[model samples]
Target chain A: MQFGPHLLLAILEGLVTASILSLTAMGLSLVFGVMRVVNVAHGEAYMLGAVLAWWVTGLIAGHPAAGFVIAAIAAPLIMGALAVASDRLVLKRLNYDPDRTIVATIGLLYIAQQTTLMSFGPDARPVEPPFNQRIALPWLERTEEGWAWFYPWGLSITSYKLFVIAAAALILVAIWLIITRTRAGLLMRATQQDSETAQAFGIPVGTVYSVVFGIGAALAALGAVLVVPIQQAHYLMGGEPLLLSFIVVIIGGLGSLPGTVIAALLIGLSDGIISVFFSPTLAKIIATLLVAMVLVFRPRGLLGKAPA
Target chain B: MLEATGLRAAYGPVEVLHDVSLTARAGEITCLLGRNGAGKSSTLKAILGLLPPSRGTVTLDGAALHALPAHEIPKRGIGYVPQGRRLFRELTVAETIEVGLMTRGEGRETRDWVLDLFPRLRERLGQQAGTLSGGEQQMLATARALCLRPKVLLLDEPTEGLQPSMIDLIRDVTVRMRDEGYAILLVEQRMDAILDLADRAVFLETGRSVETVARADLTPQTLHRRLGV
Candidate 1:
């Protein structure tokens, strides 16, 4: 069987896609798990991150890579502040009622989307890829047999895709370590498990929620910056990923880190394979159906326990 | 070492505690006895600053506690084991204790001390707190509160659903803390245990202090009449 270069490229794209999805979904999961508020505006926050990255990159005199670094660092700080302000001004007053919170976040999301559309315009903006040169994997190359063979025999991959995979893996590990190994992590886990108990233990539950929201916002911003090279910056770019991230979170289980990563990868692979055999619209429909089925059978998600 | 004077609190317009006055001296166990909703939990919460008093004062060693937040209260040498043994259910017993110590910024020394006090906890340190039996959870809650090395420990309903043996273990621990010069304010339903362990007792009825008696002065008939038992 001959595995063409195009198919290999698709697989590589799937990995990168999964990486971006994981980053965005992790934040959504944390906020939902700990706060029990379905922040419909999370997507808008991601869009805001991309906008900040675009604006910051324009200001800094550096390569596209440096631009990404600047955007990644700055966007989260800005978005986090916004999230905290939103919580205090609006969501906090609602007393964390889930239905009310969802409605309020939806309103905020539309406001955010409109603000970006009005300011940045509808056209897609170009963003320079951080690196200019493409690196080839010499170990996996085309042979007399074809592109499909043992890694030592006949397969090839791009260095850019590998970088994306490596970055995502590093982030996943770092998040795991921070949650399990550090004091802040323990507090976060405690808050997630039971806010009332955590508060009684001399933990400032409000501060923990604010900081978690900040970190969650920052992660989404980081994902936007990372995705700039592949998808370019645009006002509407956040919508697709936002929907995909929700699917990822639901599939991964409402707050499990390991589940989020696995779900992201599955979504990425399925999308890639389906897009190869079918249209993007059909692939999306299939993805939605898959999520609905999974939810119907195991509402808690793949790794999630039933909510207490 | 802990005192509340003229403390008044309300949930909305309905007051739960009114002009509540009490004291827990160092080297003594002061137990509060009341029927359900008699403001036993509310008094503990008011002292810890969990519920801001509409009027009155809470002082720890003569330091004003009203202005400070709940988390800050623990730092000032007051440990609280709230109602329902509010242990972090998902965390292991060791982790639950460790979190209490985190606020103090002290290391393993505090944890080791708590474990020594509750040696059974040492055996179940790695077990999830929620998986522990009611008695074990109560022990874990007390151990977690003590991890802060507070001068005063506040316990609410500490022996609600424990076997008699576990209740005895908890009473022994309270007595030991009192001997070690730590002040304790305990709220409990087990009248016999309270009578045995407490140096003095305060009774509340409908959010008002109805009686304050020496532990030796309490009799079954007196308790029955006063508490409507």
Candidate 2:
């Protein structure tokens, strides 16, 4: 393919990656931002979403859209419940001590992985897309008569992929509204700012933490549900997303939602483009190098506040 | 009335408050005075259940508070302003007050009354608490607590770092709360503030209540002997 068409395809692929990455990374960032807990099991929650999506859709019949819709709704809610249970049963008991929570979540990661392996098995399973009509894209070119448009070979995107991008954008906006405009969001921000003070003011910080954990896991699950059609569900699939999300969260600035989204775009786009031009391994290496540069130059992160 | 008796609390294995007791009655300002590390703040913490007491009973109007969680104590009509102001730095002044009122399910009337008390806060309602001047932040913290309309208010060094004018404003507000028939427990290091505002004083030394005296009995010699200032 020519450079122009190839570049366009790469950008389209990058948007899909970015869309999914933002949701996954935002979940991790929200958990860290509000609860001050690095949820190492976040990626497992994502895998559970994909696996559950497969199960839920398999349970249903008729139109693919009906199964897809049910799977999307049920998977996240289940993931959220699991997350809340872990938060209450595990993280809360640790008193949310930073070091202790990390260790606890690492334990949770293994437990989730092993449990999923036992129940769902180790096979990678694909979920059918609700609608996947491929639309050929047009390219601009100078002809003998004048400038014209033509269908470029292998330059197209699936309708489902576009839907993923649009859906992610809408979800991000909805999350932004919840954080900035609602009373629950106000309570969350209050707890994030000063939990002791929030508790003193009767904000029920523990309950808030539970709810935040549930929401964070739900978000990651939602992303997984969306991506399961393109990728396959497997117990081990969480490892890559976890590593990529950690990188995005660190580069974007810890716990900053906008920073998370922006960093996801940067990393995701670079990953997609570089994979097309060079190799996926080289893209990951470049991303790691970027994180190192960010750590050395901007340790607080792209948008993280300086320590008070 | 709010009373804490035989209070004992520890951080880790080290007891910081030992057998400290005090009473804060309605329509009066009860001050806790001592040198640093003398368990004044710890006494307040025990009362609020922030540091659960090993041996103590806190009663607010005959209801036991020590058995309750720290967050529950506030919902039972007690407000606290911790040392260092502890404001939600990112929240607007209006939002800070709203958070305080949320537990009590208060409405615009309580918010308006708090705003009326600190009119300067009303002017900066949309400003972030962290960006406010030190004096303004103190006012907002007190204002946020007041929005709860609690029967009891616990303030720990509310005037720790403020200008003379701001100090006077806080003192005036504290006095007004007293006159409004609220039970107030105050922790302070400033002798002038105690002299100006305290109806009764409890002095502490090394985690023990050394003495309890009336404002009139708090002479300079007594203050010098008890506070070591």
Candidate 3:
């Protein structure tokens, strides 16, 4: 492929990765931002989503879209319920002490991964996309004719890939609206700012924590459902998502929604382009170093303010 | 009316409040007066369930409160303007009020009423609470609590760091609230404010409710003797 076409393909691939990553990272960010709890099991929730999506799709008949739709709706709901149960049974008992919650969630991560391994088996499995018609992308060039558009070889994207990006964008916009424009979101932000004061004013903060935890897990599950067709599901697939999300959330700034998206895009595109041009290992090493540099110079993140 | 009896609370092993008790009746500003570390703030905290009393009963019009959690206490008709204003700093002035209203399932009518009381807040509705002047922040804090439309209102040093004009505004609000039949529990150190607003004063000394003085008996000498100024 020519340079322009190759680069375009890499960018397209990066957008798909960025979409999935932003959803996963956002889940972690919301839980951290609101409850001040670092949920180490967040990636396990994503894994569970993928596993459940595979199961649901297998159970369904008829069109591939039918199963995909059912899995999309059911997986997140199940993850949300499980997350809320864990929060109430474990984190709440631990008093959501930052140090203790980390340890507790780490235990949750292991349990979730092992449970999936045992039930779902250790094999990596893929879900078929609802629709994947590939369309050749055209590149503009100055030819003998003033300006000409020609199809670049291998410069194409599946319809499903475009759908994934659109879905993620829509979901993110919905989340933004909820946070900025809704009563539930207002209460969540209030709880995040000052739990003590929120409680003093009759906001049931414990309920809010449970809801936030559930929502966070649901978001991760949604990401997994979306990406399962692109990437195979395995119990161990969570580790990469977890590590990458931590890096993204750190680079984006703690608890910043916009920062998370931008950082995800930056990291995702770079990972794609670099892996294509050099190596995936090199891409990851560069990302890790970027995180270290961010920590050293701008610990609060690109958009984070001084700790309130 | 709101009543707390035999309220005892501790910060870890260190006891901050022991055997404190007080009553705030409707149409009255019941002031809690004491020197520093006298458990005045702790008393209010215990009542609000912020610091759950190790042993006590808080009742509002005969309903038990100490049995509930901090969040539930406010829903049982108590509003608190805590020390330091405790405003949601990042939230805009309008959003801060919205939180208060959301807590009680209140509507725009109450918001309009609160805005009328502190018209200054209406102008800065779009500004973040942290960006407000000290007086404006205090107003926002008080206005937030009032949005609850609670039967019992708790104000902890509402005018502590205010200018005289702001202090007068707070005093007037307290008086007006009291006249509207809200039970007001005020924690204060200023003699002038206590004299002007308190219908009765509860004196605390070393985590204990030592005395209760009616407004008629709240002379400067009594305040000086009880407060040790």
Return the TM-score for each candidate structure: 0.92, 0.98, 0.98
> How much is B37 displaced in model 1, in angstroms?
2.1
Q: Which prediction has more favorable lDDT, 1 or 3?
A: 3
- The local lDDT score (0 to 100) that residue B206 gets in candidate 2 is 94
DockQ for model 2 equals: 0.83
Please name the candidate that would achieve the greatest lDDT relative to the true structure. 3
> What DockQ do you compute for every candidate structure?
0.62, 0.83, 0.85
Clashing pairs in 2: none
TM-score of chain B of each: 0.94, 0.97, 0.98
Query: Candidate 3, residues B1-229: lDDT per residue as tens digits?
Result: 8999989999879999989988999999999988899998889989999898999899999999999989988888899998989999999999999888877788999999999999999999999999999999999999999999999999999988999999999989989999999999999877776686789999999999999999899888897788767
- For candidate 1, list the clashing residue pairs, or say none: A140-A155
lDDT of 2 at A262: 94
lDDT of 1 by residue, A1-308 (tens): 24555566567767888898899999898888888888888877778888888888888786677877777788888998888888878877887789999999999988888888899898777666676455543334566888643433334455656777888789888998999888889999899898766766778877887778777877887788777666767777777888998899999998888899999999987787678657678878987997899889989888988744
- lDDT per residue for candidate 2 within A106-203, as digits (tens), equals 99999989999999898999999999999999999889999999998899999999999999999999999999999999999999988878888888
The residue ranges of model 3 lying beyond 4 angstroms of the native Cα positions read: none
**Per-residue lDDT over A1-308 for candidate 3, one digit per residue giving the tens place of the 0 to 100 score:** 88988998889888988999999999999999999999999999999999999999999999999999999999999999999999999999999999999999999999999999889899999999999999899998888868989997779999999999999999999999999999899989999999999999888999999999999999999999999999988999999999999999999999988999999999999998998888899999999999999999999998777865
Give each model's whole-structure lDDT. 0.83, 0.92, 0.93
True contacts kept of each: 0.61, 0.80, 0.91
Best-matching candidate per DockQ: 3
Give the runs in model 1 whose Cα sits over 4 Å from its true position: A1-8, A132-158, B12-14
